[model samples]
Target: IDGEQINLSIWDTAGQEEYDRLRTLSYPGTDVFMFCFSVVKPDSFDNLRDKWLPEIRQHCPEAILMLVGCKNDLRFTLFNKFQNQERKFVTSDEGEYMAAVLGAHGYFEVPSFHHSKVAPIFHEGAREALRRRR
Candidate 1:
């Protein structure tokens, strides 16, 4: 990150109800919380507010929060296929707006399958964590 080497460890527990207690245990040393949702699923975006954010705030209040819209490729594909129908996917503008509303450190739309494209998310996250530490 910015010519410095950063050691980052990520614990992605995407709201597993059965391991809610176990998940909270990993929150102690967390520097950044990447709250991710599918762009195709509006309900998942809602979960960021209805479920994830509150939990993260409760456990790690000072942690840097990032709003990530996953499966962005699917959003474009689905939208093209359903062009004549009603568009149900969440828009990029909406994701950015939510990030602002939640006071997230960053907002990213990524296709999980592509490692090259996904690298920025972690790089930016590490940069933010380093910035916060200073």
Candidate 2:
């Protein structure tokens, strides 16, 4: 992006149990793995440790892993309007700690509609991929 054009191809795996075996087929050439979870959905974050991390490690141990907390806007909205609601939203501290525990290269929070916020995550992933090549 800094005066250079990078071509990136992304493969999004289905979260369905039926696709679990098929997902590993695309792991071989993956440059970076963006393990994303919604801040508003605590179960998705739990899956990172319970499901995704083990699968990724088994298939692509050398891949650069980045942990992303999505739906930041939802979390903020809920916080402002319904602070006492019995809902769980992930905090930046929790994301950072999990990233550390999972050996992720970085942790980021991104709102769904904020395209600008997502760019740096991919940029970092691409940079890490390139750095690993060297």
Candidate 3:
């Protein structure tokens, strides 16, 4: 990234079970794998260790992995809206702990529609890929 032009391609299949078979076909040449889950959805975070991490590792065992908690902006909003009801949101501490347990390269909690926030995830990915290239 330091004076070098890097073309980073991102594929977000959104983990639709209907395309599970087809989705993994694109995993072969992936340099970085960002296993993302919604911060507002504890189930999605649980799926990371139960589903995603295993699937990606099966295909790309030594992949440079990052755990991303998406829709962070909604965490508080959803909690307030559903304040009377019981709900569980994935905490930043849990995300960080999971990343450490998974041996991920990094972990991020990001708001939707913020390019300033999103860019660093890819930037780190690009830098890691570049370093590995050398």
Candidate 4:
């Protein structure tokens, strides 16, 4: 995505039921996926895995799903409510763990504090994964 042009399909799955049929269509050929949530939201890694992840795995068995906790500006919100007090930066530990279970490559995080920083992380991660696969 830097100087080269590569076709990338990034799907934002709606939690709504209406998209259930459509979601199945994307199950295949999904090399990587980024599941994003706001850091300010009252959720933790375990909670996220329980509520949202199983369905994603069911749909995209081949896709590497990356759990991304976004919004870097909400430190107080993250610590105060979510109780992920030690989560100051992003890591792919959870991502890789899930990936291992699901036969995927791995996972990572991106702070949505600035679009500029977040954009490259996704593109670069995807590109690198693709390269390694080849």
Candidate 4, residues 35-114, lDDT tens digits: the string is 66654453555445665567766776555666566664565555677675555433345445654664444444545556
| lDDT of predicted model 2 | 0.90
lDDT of 1 by residue, 1-134 (tens): 88998788877784768988888988998999888899999999999988888998999999999998999999879988999998799889999999999989978998959868778888888988889899
Give me the runs in candidate 1 sitting further than 4 Å from their true place.
Answer: none
Better of 2 and 3 by lDDT: 2
Arrange candidates by TM-score, descending. Answer: 2, 3, 1, 4
- List candidate 2 segments past 4 Å from native: 1-6
Lowest-scoring 10 consecutive residues by lDDT in candidate 1? Answer: 7-16
- Which 10-residue window in model 4 sums to the lowest lDDT? 86-95
What Cα-based lDDT does every candidate model obtain?
Answer: 0.89, 0.90, 0.90, 0.60
- True lDDT of residue 125, candidate 1: 86
CA error at residue 133 for candidate 4, angstroms: 2.7
RMSD of each predicted structure: 1.5, 1.5, 1.4, 4.8
Query: By the lDDT metric, which is better: model 3 or model 4?
Result: 3
Better of 2 and 3 by TM-score: 2
Sequence-dependent TM-score of model 1: 0.91
Model 2 is weakest, by summed lDDT over 10 consecutive residues, at 1-10
